[model samples]
Target: MTAQSAHLDDELNLKALSFHAQPRPGKIGTLVTKPAATQQDLALAYTPGVAEPVRRIHTDPDLAYAYTNKGNLVAVITDGTAVLGLGNVGPLAGKPVMEGKAVLFKRFADIDCFDIEVQAETPEAFIETVVRIAPTFGGINLEDIAAPHCFEIEQALIDELDIPVFHDDQHGTAIILAAGLLNALELQGKTLEEAQIVILGAGAAGIASARLLLALGAHRDHLLCVDRQGVIHLGRPDLNPYKFGVAVETNKRTLTEAMQGADVFIGLSGPDLVTPEMIASMAPRPIVFALSNPVPEIRPAAALAVRSDLVMATGRSDYPNQVNNVLGFPFIFRGALDVRASRINQAMRIAAVEALRDLAREPVPQAVLDAYGLNALSFGPDYIIPKPFDPRLRERVAGAVAQTAIASGVARLPLSD
Candidate 1:
């Protein structure tokens, strides 16, 4: 790092510490939505009047939606095994991220959230903890859990509970990625079925992205998933079930080999793992989403220096095409909560993908342009995904998800307006 960049990093670190410390040391808190100043309000909020709703709900369990916060509340649960780029920080340290997720939900979707950190010794224990408390909220946003275990926990929760359970690291990344990739392919005059896609990092995000891409019509044979051990081919004996799910029959055994003549490169691995040689080896007009955070696999400047025909994206706000999960999760949960969806099904995910993909093709709003300090942006190489600050995302993505849930018969309530 340069002296200037080092100084900037120091400044950001100090500012972040101060920001988190000054505001009473946390990012979220509960707020009373009802009047509570009088004795009658107390009686209605807690004792006598609350008993009526309790009785009604005891007779018919669905009345909890009408009588309590269950209709619009989400539980942001985490075990801290995979907190951001920092791994295994534990539940106490993971609280801040969960709270940050709650802030985004409220900021973007007007939804209420309770951040829950579980101190469980095993994955089964964590699953039980969340299942026991599942009735308190409309949906669950599983955050910061490690792979393989995360996949198991989320699946168990979805099967056991009658609410949406989403692991944001997995599906949120996949949704935004698919949306951007679709637009990028269109601009490059290619198609998902024909593109040679290589996904580096066979963890949660990489595997999920591969699955969603296949669902969106990408040929399974055209995709390759690589990890620390190289390509996850069919002959690998140590592959987990999740990694094995996306394993293809390929002769390639390394990331360098996998990138040869590839049309798309998705990096969920650590920073600087991709070289300029790898970028140069890809097919013409290749689309690359170097999505590792704080730093990408290959910096945009370095990647662009090699191939100007590349369509690049990162998980950074400073970049032109940022694949942020905030663009998907808030609105997705909003729609699921609004319609009382039984689960966040594949149809709902595809609906979100299409909504985000279609939104980018539309005219960029002035407010969004101002937010980014850009005079204009259009659907092209540099702007393949919708900006997070775009106000249309809430209505557009949420409405599509809710409608798809209803059509797919997983929604218990009809959409209002």
Candidate 2:
């Protein structure tokens, strides 16, 4: 075999070994920057001069950022119950995903982050664990925790912690989906409130997305929540407490009948739940978000085959209108931490959606196309958002988040730039 063939074989072997070995084995590591040159330098750097700055921070708390890494640091915390599309993988198994999130935080937002896989047996216990470690981090990013419980945990953390607490699974997915939906709706000449929408799942992303769509001005009567048992309409005995609450708030038309003729279909459920016939049944030029990871609720080819006037998005990157949460969370947290935000309010999230929507309207940058290795990209029915590799994310998305944080009165330090 050729040398290239041998190299490929070796790479494959390493990957195979990694599956049995730890997914990501190491804990946090530190690097020393300024070396202690002489005894005088050592004394100033280690003890004497360090004391002076420490004393100043004691007098004024905001100086902590100036003297330490507090401004740049973010804590990526997870109970690991819900690991991506892979459900209920334990804390140790979820470390790789958390580490991936930390890598994105560093790469996309220029933020320093550490992944903490807390093995808390219960929801209340998990909240306590996060709160105890809260001071060490400037901001907290909750990741991969399971639903209903995720909702409670997020609310408790935001209420308890002084620093910003964000659940990427919930709000991150919601923000990106909202941005895509906004652009897709406009392209189809439809208004958000007038559209009849259906969501297939009621998990973390689904619940958050439903609430966010409502906040974005979609009428309650126009939205439907469908789980394992048909649609979640009022008087449904099978609905869980969480699903039941949403039912009371939405789907007022007694339209628990079927998925036919809905203006939009957003599936946070598993693969192949929606058929081509269902897509054909939707209103003319319907928008669809089949956001199941690894496999979508309805394949793009099948969806397009049914309705030529459709705008479809999925969580997978290979397709057009990829609605991954990576597009929103890192930049959202970056903006919040930059301003020392107290919390990530709806305004900050909506601002991110608006920024993402605007990005679709502009001419796709050469850098963006090159990153994706595409010959050309355009603004139209097909192309709606920039791929994750687009470099403009650092400034554009973060800037909008920080501005909204300040305007909404949640930011302690306003954005200087």
Candidate 3:
């Protein structure tokens, strides 16, 4: 309905820089819940009065919910090995991203977060550190750690901790991708089972998304995942366990080979890796989600230049159908925290997927339309996923998660059912 101007990038960048700097050098900070404006308030907030709740929590661990902020709090933890598009920037450098995660948590879902950047040299140490501080929050959201190790670290934490430990990079991206893909395919008259899908990155998001799509009835034999060395096929010497598990015996040996007549392309890989020629080679009415951040595998303009029949989505907000993690993580954690779920299981994720898919088909609210300055938005090629600022995301996604957690028997608190 509207077109973005050419100077939008520079304007956005300058505003972002100024906002971050003017907002006291960082994005988030702690807020005191209990008042301490007076001497009486101080005593009740800290000294003898605080001792009573501490004693109760010590006696009954569950009392931490009533005594402390643990019930609504999540820890955004990272090892800085995979800081967004900037790979392996180290733990200290990853603080801002973690803080941004915290900001999203608070802003979107009314959930609180403490961003923790770990300096551990090993996944074992990182896991240990998180475990040591597990009691500090209701949930743990693992962020921006590199692949393979990210998988291992998340699995370890989930197995060891009673609280929910989720790797947002892996599962968050996967959930959002699945939701959008489901809707996009529905609009395009393609089923996940019938689609020939190619994912151009075998890292956390790619492998996880492929696995999820399979769980949702995608034809395993029709899928191809390519890394820098090319398609992750059987007998590939460099395959890690994650890739190895998903790499079936397929004839497609390279990105080019995999793109031939494919029904869908999902890119979690680097910039400009996909060309207009590659998009043109896809099957009729193809679905493309070029989700690489800052820069995508192929720009929408370039891809559309070659094929007008296809549906395209990028990770940028400037584009239509942004497959943003913001649409997944905050509300997912919201639902999990509400129900006090032990873990974010597959059932919960499926609920999120279904909720998101169903929401996109509904009428867009005026507030949401106003946020984007749009005249109209609908469940078409341009609007396949719900916007981040849509108020319904909190109610729909979070409620679905909490209900699923209850139905799946993972919820600890009686928040539902």
Q: For this target, which candidate reaches the highest lDDT against the unseen true structure?
A: 1
Per-model lDDT:
0.95, 0.85, 0.92
Off by over 4 Å in 1: none
* lDDT (10s digit) by residue, model 3, range 246-339: 8979777889989999999999998999999899899999999999988899999999999999998999998999999989899999999998
lDDT against true structure, model 1: 0.95
RMSD for each of the candidates:
0.8, 4.4, 2.5
The superposed Cα distance between candidate 1 and the true structure at residue 361, in angstroms, equals 0.6
Candidate 3 segments exceeding 4 Å error: 1-14
So what's the TM-score on candidate 2?
Answer: 0.90
- Shift in Å, residue 407, candidate 2: 1.2
Worst 10 residues of 2 by lDDT: 249-258
Query: After best superposition, candidate 2 residue 67: deviation in angstroms?
Result: 1.4
> Tens digits of per-residue lDDT for model 1 on 292-317?
98889999999999999999999999
Clashing pairs in 3: none
Candidate 2 per-residue lDDT, tens place, 1-417, comes to 469968987997798667546655543355555677899889978787789988999999878888888878888988889997788999988987787788888778778888899999999999999999887789999999998899899999999988888998889988999999988999999999899899889888888899999999988878888877667788776766677766855443322345778999999989888888888888999998999977899899989987899999999887898997778988998899888898889999999999998888888889888888889888777778767888888789999999999999998886887
